[model samples]
Target: MDMTLKDLRIHKGLTQIEASRICNIPLRTYKRIESSVTYLNNPKYQYAFELLDKYVVNKNNECSFNSALVIGAGYVGLSISVLLSQYLDVTVIDINKDKVDCVNNREPLFKDKDIEDYFKNKRLRLTASLPNKELYKDKDIIIIAIPTDFNKETGLLDTSGISNLVKEIRTINKHSLIVIKSTCYVGFTDSLNDKNVMFSPEFLREGHALHDNLYPSRIIIGGDKNNKKVKEYAKLMQSCSLNRAKTLYMSTKEAEAVKLFSNTYLAMRVAYFNELDSFAMNHDIDAKSIVEGVSLDPRIGDYYNNPSFGYGGYCLPKDTDSLITQMKSISNSELISSISHSNQSRKEMIAGDIINRLNGHGVVGIYSIQSKKDSDNKRYAAILDIVSLLKDRNINVIYYQPHEMSLDDFKKQSDIILVNRYHPLLEDVKEKVYTRDLFLRD
Candidate 1:
């Protein structure tokens, strides 16, 4: 199939404005070239395409392994499958029939726009099926991206999802190079004692999984660096990405710690900003200005500088807690240990402030239970905890059901609306809305 200018741009991980800047074309002209076939036939097309060609992934270069078996149709698994499927044939297996059907129907299981566009336009050599022993045979590589839910009882990750599946896949196919992309505890790969097993942690955000894969910050191969498969797999991922990403090879245990530490650091940053915002609120100072001023330092970048109720997404809360658990056995980790507690206190303070706003009596309408705007994922959103705290205080909470409750009706029904991230839809009811989102970009 002939690649369109849009396809090349997306694969190159360049925004329209960036592509325009590189090709010395106007942004409007670039958009027209990408959107219209007639405009794409113009002379501008050749210049733009040729300029961007070197930056895009070259699918012409073939790999040794043509087909891959990916376990779990979750974010990481699905993104990797789509990335490799651009050049290699990939089959994804999930126990969830709904996810399998969605993949087969070219429907995205989540809210990633890149995945949606790829499903609609790109003929990715990808398929999905339910887990079976017969399907696991003869695959070049197998990736495990299942959820490693935090076990509060044990104070560690419940990685049985990965452990059990690895054993099962080994029973079916011992030769396939199995890669562990799931978040695992330290020594997880060592615990398996299998030569083929390796742990390569995924470091992508919730909604932008596929885009991050295409332009990864770093490609890490966590296993015996000298192993032939490990080196080849690194080359495969490097070739598939938009740019030449630096690759790191380390022991699986170090890789496991890298995932935990990286996420814990992010959670720490979130906690830091939330605490700063809390202090600002206590003193009635301008939080945004203080945050912006402090973020001027290059080390303290403004990426995760936005403050909210707390860091309660899929990774931050659980990973921080798990790391704290790991630190308990050591002699000193007081700094690393305080992140979860700070998060909890922030939530309580926010809840208390909300109650003060209500004067201890009012119905609260939730704009969204999701952590971020335009996402269906609510795994551990802070709003849910806030709602629970409100319920404990005898406050009624109602959700914005667009199909049933009209916006005006929803606004009228509640004395206050609790939104973690502000949306324009609630502009009419701004007085009734309560949000801590100062920077407005989630």
Candidate 2:
């Protein structure tokens, strides 16, 4: 049944101004479209339809609580914000004004297919704003998903951001549960010593964050299982999840250990496989053939074994380094430290091999700085280190930037092009391309 635009607007429970603001249409423009019979005849009608593809659902009151606030609008923060907003009100705040604006406009801060879909069609009681104390107070739960970058100088995770935020939150809101989702140094959560402050580490991939949250592998909430607040928050998370993920309760320190150790173990696997690939390359054997043969073992499995430049991303690099530093107290195993050492050696080996292939003097071009084909995130990418190594050897290296230079020009200028991941765009110049991507999957 075709209804008038006014009737449709009323059905969606939006006032004229509210509809205009949420849809990003000017107030005056919306009013004209509503009353004018020429709306279908005018071009403005098409724009209005596109905006109405999604509508805002305000102040959802379905879950354990009505309100939650997430700190840091980066990958972790924004992903969880979109996930939790389905069941309750969620306000995502960040220091960056542009990121905040992006969230408020219902635009993705980064590329995630699930998040993009949810933003357009799902019932999201989500908002984004600058960091405000008033927004922090009165929320049932305050999730701290801010970055705790590993500080090279201090040899510790720079948790000053989380520490200061906790201090501030305690001063204003005493009842709300403050959940720490940021990756931290082992025992960093217990070091805070606040019963209200709990640590729950997120085990999400780089590009597939929200999808993982919806179907989480496990939900580990660190604190006393007996505590009402702890149980309530756990319930809140389970309610949001599509799968009934196993919920594990443990000490804050143990939960912290789980996150660090898990990532370190994955890094170790990467280093292990990368070392194997290095061996295969050294012997001039088919790397993929050997990889497939070894992966045939049932116990070893056939996952996360794709060879690359090295395992260099936000979680693996930072968490492995932090874990290596944290493990210095009791266990002094050279093996744990060597995971990072192995990665370094692998990059150096790769750089040397590339230079040797160039026969000492030639301009080398880099295809992309990103570790993955789809991802734009370049945090701690392995290519950066390789570039540094090449520069030290007096090798002239150029990067293929889409905006500054054309693809054909980039291909034409360099004697040999280095890519961490292979792409079809460079297929025409196959012999000139160099990469370790065996399976051609990220």
Candidate 3:
């Protein structure tokens, strides 16, 4: 089969318009090129490959890699490894033994639906402990997908993991192009001064991480242009992506800033809606009705306007907090900081309200701590703030969902349930329960 430019571009997940913009050509011209009628003679097409490296695990067919090693078993790492396994011999390395074992057994670590199939067919090799340096020592690419959590006290991500990992990679495998998928502050990759280093931001949501990887919104790759390795790395990454999304290449610091600012803006939007809901709630006004009316305007749109206690997730809370702290020299991010502060206040108020509603100290049952309805995770869940607040007031905060905790005695001792969202079995304790889930939906 004669592979047309459109076929290659589409397999790489690029729309004609996106291809045009990436190639710096007219949309009409790009369309004809993607339609296979014209050969893509534009030099800008090379830029797309660099951007594709930011999002895709392996380039489609441009680069030859005998084996690939991915560190970290978290959602981003797992997703990247699975995608790469489709085209290359891929092995996942993580410090967590259970996570590696689970992946080896075809078990879903997080709530991803597509992970099992990736494992069942023996596509990706999963392993605990460090990847054998002698084995991946010759691999073309070694991706760092480890968690870089923001320290609550320092207002910066604890990139010690990344730093150490990079040092190890440099010591063990100096030639492998190191792609950092973990989110970090702006100029993070620049500080390391590694010509092979590239900052690729992950845009995957918690529950739909793999699916998002399968059909990404866009791919971005950023590093210094002087580094030929970075350019080749980007090309390899673009070749591996879904092949239909647009890939944009820029500098490393710009990629880092894009990740932080993107999340901060989302936190700002969440805060905006929560503030609106709080206003409606205090005045005994119908929040949903008012929100519906406001969202009907085409300019504003309707999605992501739902009011919640606050924005608390693995990504939003730390990213916003980190961005706020990183704004020491910059003066423009005050509004973003306020959005994060507003979320904290909302959580405090929700806890206070629940506490005040209770007549006496009883076993106050805490429902699913996961902010969203369908998720099984509770790390950085907003409900934990409620737990802390109520505990300070001498209320017994008994957690019912063991999915988030190791405590086994929780189910046996709770008289009053505090659920953010309601369920049918909660009817028995309905009179004693206190919740802000007025509409019974997330």
Candidate 4:
């Protein structure tokens, strides 16, 4: 099959510079290939394509799964259910009636354009139902996509939900391949009593879950790599994805570590940039300009470099803390511990800066409570913490959310508005707004 340079780069999970280096070509030459300025017959283009071909899936080796039951209606589970439904008889099980109804009605529980489009146009062989013992026994594969939220008091991921689900699955079905897609502590898969159990780490962004799954950077499956069933499951996933992402098989413990460490590293990068933005802001310098200069190094590309209140999404905070909890026995954990601290400090700095701008006594209007724009999920959002901090200082606050009040009314009532990210609605009251969103993109 023919492939574009852009497709190859995304499949290999490499930046243009990295891909160019691997192909032994100049950056400009790679750009030309990526932009299709260079013809496919060109020697350099052919060479680059040949190098990327190593990562592509062999379509002839694809496998088919008859049936799959995915647990949870959240992003990870829902997206995986939809993807698998294209080729397999997929049933999504959720405890929440609302979520089940929404899926049954061909509606997405959350805001994802790709999912919305799929529901509108595609004839998916998918269904949703409440948890039942018979359903577990009927499916050929059982996927555990339940949430394992980090319990702050326990200092670890609350894996009770996963553990309970695994037990129930084992009791009902001894033949199904049980895959754990939830984020868990290291060595979580090995601790499970079932030999058929596996851990497959999911890397998806909020509001883009399905799209990311369709064109994933890489697919990592942890379990018995040599097992025929495991290999078949991996190939099934490969055939289902749009990109046919590069697949890796490793020990269960290593796969779990990959999930935690991958998220923690992203958290660290966010903290690093936030600290840079903080320093620039304190010294009255342009944070954006500094970031642009720094990102030109190619090693630190421009993606995910935008400044925010802090890294407060579903995965980063929990995964970082979970890693810290797992690394307690290790001697050198200062860097791991410091990532959480840096994030907290970043939020505190933002709150303090907003307060300082208002002279400590004024109505602070919050634009939205969601973690980021285009996302309905506000769990662990930094703005919530900032609101609490402002409230403790006896500062009056109002939410400018459209659901709560009209934009015209919100503008008239608030003395100052605080937005985590820039928006066109805040353009009218630019002088009254306080935000760290310099580049305007999320």
What C-alpha lDDT do the candidate models reach, one value each?
A: 0.87, 0.85, 0.74, 0.85
Q: Per-residue lDDT of 229-265 in model 2, one digit per residue for the tens?
A: 8888887776555556889999998999999899999
Each prediction's total of clashing residue pairs, residues at least 3 apart in sequence or on different chains, is 0, 0, 15, 0
Candidate 4 TM-score, C-alpha based:
0.86
Q: What is the lDDT of residue 26 in candidate 4?
A: 91
Residue 366 miss distance in model 4 (angstroms) = 0.8
Model 1 — which ten-residue stretch has the worst lDDT?
54-63
Cα error of candidate 4 at position 128, Å:
0.3
Across 1-442, the per-residue lDDT of candidate 4 in tens digits comes to: 2347787677556788888887888999888877876456677777788776544433322454678999998999999998777667889999999999999999879989888887886668899999888899877789999999998888888888999988887788877899999998997789886678999999999988888888888899999988778888887877666686889999888999999999999999989989999999989999999999999989999878888889897889999999999888899778988999999989889888878877999888887777678798888888888889889888899987677789988888888888878789778889988777877887
Q: Cα deviation of 134 in candidate 4 (Å)?
A: 1.0
Where does model 4 exceed 4 Å of error? Answer: 1-64
| Number of the top-ranking candidate, with TM-score as the measure | 1
Q: Please tell me which model should have the higher TM-score, number 2 or number 3.
A: 2
| Ordered list by lDDT, greatest first | 1, 2, 4, 3
lDDT of 1 at 170: 82
Q: State which candidate, 1 or 2, has the greater lDDT.
A: 1
Q: Which residue runs of candidate 1 sit more than 4 Å off their true CA positions?
A: 1-61
Q: How accurate is candidate 3 locally (lDDT)?
A: 0.74
Off by over 4 Å in 2: 1-62
TM-score of each model, paired residue for residue: 0.89, 0.85, 0.80, 0.86
